[model samples]
Target: MFRFALSLTLALLATQATAAEAEPRWMVTTTGGAFARDNDQAHSFGSLAVTRKIGRGYVSASVTRFGSAVRQVDVTLPSTYTIGFLSAGAVHGAWFYDGYVSLGRQHYKSVVTDLGERDVAGFSHSPVYGAGGDLGAVRWIGRSWSVTPSASLQWIKSRALRGQIGPRGGSEFETRETGVTLGAGLRVDKFFGASHGDSVSLRLTRFQTTNASAALSSGMRGAFNPSAQSGRTSDAWAEVGASATWRVDHRLYLDVGAVRTLGALGGDMTTGSAGARLLF
Candidate 1:
């Protein structure tokens, strides 16, 4: 997937270079990073995006691959996701509006653990799909600052899964799980440099969960259901971050940032990332 996106982006870059004598109309960005969790567990992610000017705004597409960790009482399930997105944005004076929709595939690993006198079990491989979208707006403050507020929604569904729990080989059960997340955030930015293109920003976001449920059947009933067995159903959490951007030239820019997720399941997570963008 990364190869395909990179190839397409390169092709577009070459095709658009002819028009670079005028104001550039296309942008390409690539970012990659890792985040840390409990027990020294580290997960990695990478993404590529291409954007083109359209009328008074812009249209974009992106591909991403990332790893996420889910904690059960005694075990951690590591999952990987591959996602693609289509996005669009429009500017009206000092106000800009944007939205994006995404589709993704997810894979989870089966795990098993021993807890003193008992054992917690594992889940069978099952088909999983996730879909989501976001709506956001930015309000420019004078020539050197801006404020952005946004809302997002996501849904994840899993096919019937066979699971096991208990001692020895454990009891077997079947279940299906679905979850939803709703989030809102605000960001403030301070731009500098002669071109006002370089900037530093601070952001705060909160997420709430709903209908994160599971249907369990067969042996041991709820013993192995992912959503049903979780410690919280309607939990909420917040994240805070700061970042900086450097305008390297008329056609290139670089970024570095860090964010921390607080009150998340399992424990807090800290992420560090760096990336570059090219305009042509």
Candidate 2:
């Protein structure tokens, strides 16, 4: 009887402590990470996100930047591509939901030594947009730490533009591409240290894209090969990645993640990122 009373007292104290550790009404985060592939050049990724409370839900806006290297025909340099989006979401108990639409410009940067040692060119450029939603739930089930599972889907469209650079000037050849992506993931979070709010979260995800393109739409057929046909082509690929996040303080956090893709019509690609987060 005495032990039972002690357990009840401890449970009430734990509940009161959790209630005192308030969740943020507004927050912002930024993360940046590097990417590497088995046989390809490296890429860089970064994002900035903002969130605010709204009637049991939250409104969010985010901007993302990614830089990648592509096969060079005539001195093609690498440049960062960008995306910006707005999202609406709700978090109730252990479940959360979010929907967002994003738009961005795609670009491949390159230098044209033939035109001028300092000349730069861009190819296979396009404007891209996508809409996506994510749903997830956390289940503690009487454990010290909780686990969350999430799933997401999105549709994307890109306007393809092929670029050529020479002694004369640069030109763009235009085309189009469309695809859809599906993803599922799980995350585990554990809190340590004297402050139960200090936590570490690890997530793993698998994603697949349909109607992906093997190569950028080049305006011209393979180097004087009249028999070659040039148009839109699509394929598919799958990728998996893991990420970790650490709470530095009540208002600060840090994160890192890595991903690797396979069956990418061209070659396998790997990506990585790390960033800091803030809550208010």
Candidate 3:
């Protein structure tokens, strides 16, 4: 899955490169964020990306590190995720499209507590891969206002045992999940500030699992036993978010964003992010 996405991205870069008529512009961005669930699970992450301008679009690559200490009731799951992404987007008249491919791995340490720690034999790190794309249209209300309606599709496949301590310390269990997410949203944007270069946006989106399944197997000694189960599950979320970008100068920009979600799967989730971008 990741290989296909990478290949497509490279091909796009090649095509864009051939059509270029002038020197390309570039931007570097660094972002950091924290995510929290109402149930007390939390994680923070940071990322860096370099993007190149090509005609009406851009191509970029980024890497992100999600820090450790995703907590559970009786145990603390100290795990780290390192993900790399390839993304490309372009604007065509009033319409725009973009997509991304992500490849990552989750590394987990042994289950730990205040008293002691235990290693679950036969447990190892897992590979993660996913791809997502969105298409939207822009409608200008005036010189400084615009509205956009968009739809998106995303797919992911990965293991889910990184933050789980299982039924027992060495009980030996593994879970695999494959899911497809569908989203639709409307966004409104307004440009403000003296130069009108600083802008803010408000968005409302709904995302639901269209096709999702999870398989679990459990037993000691790496056995495939009767306890295994595979089934389909449905989950949905409604999210509202606001984000703003401040153009400090011609070469630098700052961004801040916050989001709130109402969902059935993990209760309500709140996420906040801040970032800076430098143009060259």
The candidate that wins on TM-score is 3
Model 3 clash pairs?
none
Candidate achieving higher lDDT, 2 or 3: 3
Q: Give per-model TM-scores.
A: 0.72, 0.71, 0.78
List the candidate 2 regions with Cα displacement exceeding 4 Å. 1-17, 69-79, 111-125, 163-172, 198-202, 214-238
What shift in Å separates residue 58 of candidate 3 from its native position after superposition? 1.4
Name the lDDT value of residue 17 in candidate 3: 31
Best by lDDT: 3
Better of 1 and 3 by TM-score: 3
Candidate 1 vs 2: which has more lDDT:
1
2 against 3, candidate with superior TM-score: 3
Candidate 2 C-alpha lDDT tens digits along 1-280: 0000111111212322445567566667666655554665555566677777665577778777766443345543444567787778766665677777877886656543356544333344667777777777767745447677778776767654345555886654545766666667776666555455444555555556554432211110000001111344444455455555565766676666555565655555655566665666
Query: Model 3 over residues 100-119: C-alpha lDDT tens digits?
Result: 88788867777776667877
Colliding residue pairs in candidate 2: 31-275, 32-274, 33-273, 33-274, 76-110, 77-109, 77-110
